[model samples]
Target: MPVDAVEVGDLLLVRPGALVPVDAVLVSEHAVLDESSLTGESLPVERVAGERVSSGAVNGASAVTMRAVALASDSEYQQIVRLVEQAAGSKAKVVRLADRYAVPFTVLSLLIAGVAWAVSGDAVRFAEVLVVATPCPLLIAAPVAFLGGMSRAARHGLIVKGGGTLEQLSRVRSAAFDKTGTITTGRPVLDRIVAAPGFDEKSVLQFAASAEVYSSHVLAKSVVAAAKQQGYALLEAREAEEIATNGVAAQFASDATAAVVTVRVGKPSWLREFAPTLAPAPLEPGELAIYVAVDGRFAGAIVMRDQARGEAGQALHDLRLLGIERTLMVTGDVAATAEPIAARLGIDEVHAECRPSDKVRIVSAVQPRPLIMVGDGLNDAPVLAAADIGFAMGARGATAASESADIVNRYDTLASLPLAVRVGKDTVRIALQSIWLGIIISVALMLVAAFGFLPALVGPGSRRSSTSSRSSVLCAPSDRARSGVRIIADRHGRSCGP
Candidate 1:
């Protein structure tokens, strides 16, 4: 079927082993969906009637009938594809100073060899100098060092997209973080269940979880999970309606109550707007709280809070010691919610209530240039592409953010960011050292050849000296030095910054 011709509410038959055509609500009693490609879930999800299934999911053994909720261009999969194209394509190609250094030395070698041949009136003299003066260090040493650095970084569980990302990391002056998932654990757990005068805590929670279970929002999942953990049985909700930018409404089938009752879950304002007869409870000091309404009355509220990552503070401290001039946090969360976390993490600046465009604008205004942005949400994708270097939390991060990033921390830690910079600087330094070593020895041999000293083959210690120089330059710097290079860890336990 043509994607453009697929209209909303059109019925589409999805066969087993085929990709879902569009974002559709399932009409079948049950459909096993493999959403690893879209949502990165490891196991298959069993979705039933009234559940929305996204495009790019592989159908299971049975055929499924679905009603299209969105067109191809407006779908979640298409949105992610656009982000990947923009993020990967927008970055400018980086040029290495080490590669530029080789150009001038090549010219110098040619000039010295040419002069020797012309003055001596022997083409054989030029051949002798050329044989000794071959620039193997420029050709072999730098690329090997860079490759070594990449491998070392991989051992630490980071995936640097290319050599350019390492080069960018080396000179980074500032770093900005996204507060929710990057600095704090993205998971917000339910903390307190505050119920109204007439309602009990358990009853309100059960009703709220039952209604919220139908939503795909992150908060909804948390509510359902918390209810399950507390041993509350979730009832089957009929005719569930998720109001646009508001609350979810459903008629709960409960054995405890004789009649079917209306239940709602969402923000207080949203609940009030959707159900005018329902009264909303006042909000307390938290961001992750959701209100619940039973029938036409206020039932209670569920408060949730996010925890800061264990390694977060230490990573910020390491970044400063790694010679980053400034560190900041940018988030869409309010000042009250964002500032306390920023203070705990030791961030120098904070930009609260930031939109995706606001984040890009903030990055452009950052002083001294060469900024790095670290984030893990789908909303952070655009700014990740805009920054000089972007580090994505790849373990449980959004696909769009990961694809947009220059460096992806594959594990659930930020410790590798500083290490990557150190390795890149060291690689460049070692490459230069090797190149100069080869050039100096080659020039001395060329000078000796100018005199036609002994013969080209009989120069004292020449072969031994060349071999020794190659070994020192080509090998890694540590215990694995024979095979690879590691970050040069000094006595102070601090990375030697660029």
Candidate 2:
């Protein structure tokens, strides 16, 4: 069967919200492609003229035409599928540096052929040795070990997205985490409420909750929660408008007076423009201060505190023990909040007040050998791509983040991170063991081929005494290597340890 079809000349296909099936070059200006399948880039990437593109990557924004650059089988997605296919069908021979050893094995096989030809002086003898000497062990053992490791990981609920990440996990020396949703639960609790100027604690919460009831932001929910817990009767609000990326503004006019009032619940920066004098100075550690205002007047400040996850400390400890030299928390959260969490979890480094792009840059600056980034939000995608290996909290992470990640925690917990590292180590061990077994078996066969024995194919010399008796070759390495009798006898008949 034909492996791939090549396009005659340059074929143009219009891609619209669909992955291109063949590698191509952009023929239209301003074409946007979603390269999640090929490059694992979560965001849509724009392609102009002369930019090379891969197959199985989606096109976005608007339809655009592209010229075929590679045949269907040679595309990136095709190669991935081919690797997975071969891996599934073959028994894994545990072998590292397979490509590195291929040349040596080929040369050795050629030498064996020449030696057999010289010894027997027959061309058929050389062919027999060549046929049996091919290293099937290398092909069969490596993948078996890899698959066994994968099976264990699947049982543990950690999904390694691909073999590349599995291999890199063994070398991870540093791990970076996105703070808000990784080290701590992303939920915030209203810890304290302060009333300003003319408002009491009860009155401030009532107005805040009234404006927040119509909003869906996490902080707004915290406000409504506080009002319910404190037994305050929230006033009905009308025409509540949520300001994007900030807070909510509600229309509240007194029933007795015809006066109109605008109640705003937001951050200190937003209110500073209107009520600069009423803005409270920033507080110290562990406090998440949110500002509130009514009719251009600062109403109060609400302080929030989020609790760290239960497994965070233990996970950090385990990572350090696994030879992860550094553990860093990178987040947009203020220094006051980030520092305490970093201290409590025993993280070695902390980078606070970082924007999404800044977090990527900060993480990218970390020691480069093998870095694993764990995150679960929209902002985590860039850093996820920047890291050598990225683990996404799949259950709670944004779809984009999950798509870009190399591995995913089906159960969102820091606890599973270390378990993943263990699986990777075990997989590498199994692969190596399989390779050694193959090598030993091949070496033993070569020795057998050197001596004439049995009618034992022309590859091995025929021995009259030992060969005439029934003899067979064993391919299993581990069983044969370990089943031999002990050789402890001494020349003087003295006892020797086995």
Candidate 3:
């Protein structure tokens, strides 16, 4: 049946690896679900009968039955979609900066032309005044400066989609970031190894990696990769058994000792049967510890975590220096997992446990107009479209996020964001300078024409010369702006030009 036809109280069958169609109460006695997309939790959750599993969570392993508790439109996933549409609809159209001055300048020119005609009763004088007061500078200068900025940003590994987005970036006062893949590396990595007494760290890691090599879990891959990275020679295991959502057990033949070694690598509770007194190491807020057992005896633990990026702290510091008044961390991860990272990165605020809708609301409510939202997930797509400026970490980010973002960081680093801001500011400055230069020269020529000092017969030639001079002045700033951007990028040890 179509999801639209799913009503409350309807019984639904969710197959393994399939998404739950709607917010539902579990009908099966036991089930496992991967809620990472909805909740940002790295680990799968176990639910029993009567538990409400949210829509969009991936059912794990076995087929399960659930009773629909909400209509499809009112489900969690649809709510996010609705919020995105609403937010996108509410976005104010971007008005070109040059247009703001064009109206006033045009009105003033018409008023001057009318007065000149009235005072001298000469139609040629009014025409001369109007010709010299043309708003060419307003039309030409801003776009050229913005294009130059966009090109410069592209060279620095930032893709700014439009001139207006670049302008908004220049004026950003606040910034919000998604935790996973934005502030931290999205995948788990082995942090450290704690070996039990009489067991060395190398042996513990080797045994665990050997067993985990046969298990298909995200954490297992990290462990195997870690062991291989350290050049640990893996032994062949005979009869490796993987217990779903628990751990893996394997028996390895020892080449040197001429004996069989049994190893267990998994959760503490799962390993407790073999190592009754298993004592796993203490974990930090965002860390996960997988216990290891060698020949039925407890053998240390391998601690792994989604480590924050090395450049994260420096990037936040640079943004603060670049006039970003407030920085916030908005994530679907829980507060306990998010707070430490936020404090470490010096973020001003932390809004944890956010659904996609919650993220949109939080980012939308952030004070100071022109806020920037940086994210890299499917869940971030809606909020990305909603923010004043959305920056997607595009190198490894979700396609939806990249599509909705106004600016994309192609280098897989946050360093481009500050560079983008600097470029925007410089570009806007150069554009205003060009506009004013054109305005001043045009006004001076208009005054001469209005005073009858410049003849009507010579008016077209003078206007051409004046426009040529204004073009030269306007073009100079683009080159200077490029040089300034290069200097700024160089100061930050980045290449900002072709």
Candidate 4:
């Protein structure tokens, strides 16, 4: 338990390598905190000069002073602490068929004992019958089988949340994947360099790449990579500045006076925010448009595209073998960008330009059968939670995604997907086997009790009752011969046998 702020008066001390336990304000200017826990970011960010810091995040780089922003009771980390506490306190609710049948079976045994005692005056015989009639099924097989399946699943790189998620996965008939970073590499890359008449592609790429040096946008990386691949010598840039939502501006050594070159990379709306009259045709399919300008005159545009992941096709094949009837790729990217990747991966369905709510809508429409959504992005969070069984791939970088998903594949191996599906089927198979085994043993007990030879105890007037009400307890291996399940426990009260 964390100490409450009111009790601790006003101040709390946090040292290097220690996680901040409360949300606070940065009193020291140079404080840097690692927010990977909440944001899934790989890098640490400088929290300087009155920035709000969240609790449960680690302090990084430099040490600084902090003032508590959220009280102990109101901290976000407290919610995580409370959830873990709740899951720990929650008990397993699983019970075998015999235990479920215990109450009614015991009642019937008592009534039969009352009649037998009244008719033959054999109270000791009634007690003996009840003792032997206890159902062995509930006491033995079911728990062992479930535990065995859990162990097998853990061996694979999949984490099954519980029996419920295991059951859901076994029934899944369809699979939905997020496009960017899922089917294809999420990073954009240089695919083509088309220069307008009179300008060579090499000369244009040199200007574009050099101007992009001042910007960190994904499009900028694509331009830079193209220049490097072509071995173009980039000219030096002067007075470079990136205008948000518009483009990048820089001075270049050119004949035109006021030779200010601006490189525009995003959507038309974003571009036209600065160059209001510079509306290019609606973006073409499968192409990311980046406009270049020289001296306030439109130069031309360079197009790029995201590439598909190497193992995507093989992953799709494995999923098909695992019995996924339909595999769909849904993404916010344009169809031109998403379609080629989908075709390469042999995806059965494709839904592009999707909003987060749209992803949920499509998932909800999945033919009323169980569906699995695989993703690793903040935008994918809603759909991940909405799916019947969500699997998070590449959990090392995205812990929020891993925690949000029902099953997390830690190694990010597409090969592990089929293994996860098999684990689900195996878990269900084991559970069913245990359930049937319990039923068989309970049936045998019912047969024995029907003979009026099993012991029973009567509770009311003129009634004989059983001394023990063990719903299912077996003493010998022969007792479970027909049950297809065995229980072996040491003197320490631990179950060991199959």
lDDT of 3 by residue, 103-168 (tens): 788788778878888899987677667656756677689999999999999999998999998778
> Model 2, 389-433: lDDT tens per residue?
878888777665776677888897889999999788777767767
lDDT of 4 by residue, 66-178 (tens): 87877777875665444333432342343333356556655765665555556657555444344444444444554565566567777875677766666676677899988
Q: What lDDT score goes with residue 182 in model 2?
A: 81
Minimal lDDT window, size 10, model 3: 474-483
Most TM-score-accurate candidate: 3
lDDT for every model?
A: 0.73, 0.67, 0.82, 0.62
Per-residue alpha-carbon lDDT of model 1 for 1-498, expressed as tens digits?
788799999999998767887899999877767654443232346787999998877786667799999999997667656655665476566787566766787677678778988999976666556556656666677777778778888888888778767667777899998877678776677768888879899988899898887765446777899899999999898779876445588997657766888898876777775546554445443345688887778888887777678788888888888789998987766677778888888899899877666777787679865888988766577778888888888886777788788888888766766776677677666766887887788688878877677344443322322333323222211212223335543343433221
Output the TM-score of candidate 3. 0.83
* Model 3 regions lying over 4 Å from their true place: 1-34, 42-52, 58-72, 460-498
Clashes of each: 0, 20, 0, 18
For residue 470, model 1's alpha carbon misses the true position, in angstroms, by 27
What ordering of candidates by lDDT runs from best to worst? 3, 1, 2, 4
Q: Name model 2 segments beyond 4 Å from true.
A: 1-97, 116-125, 191-217, 223-282, 289-302, 334-336, 353-365, 454-498
Stronger candidate by lDDT (2 vs 3): 3
Q: For model 1, state the Cα shift of residue 423 in Å.
A: 3.6
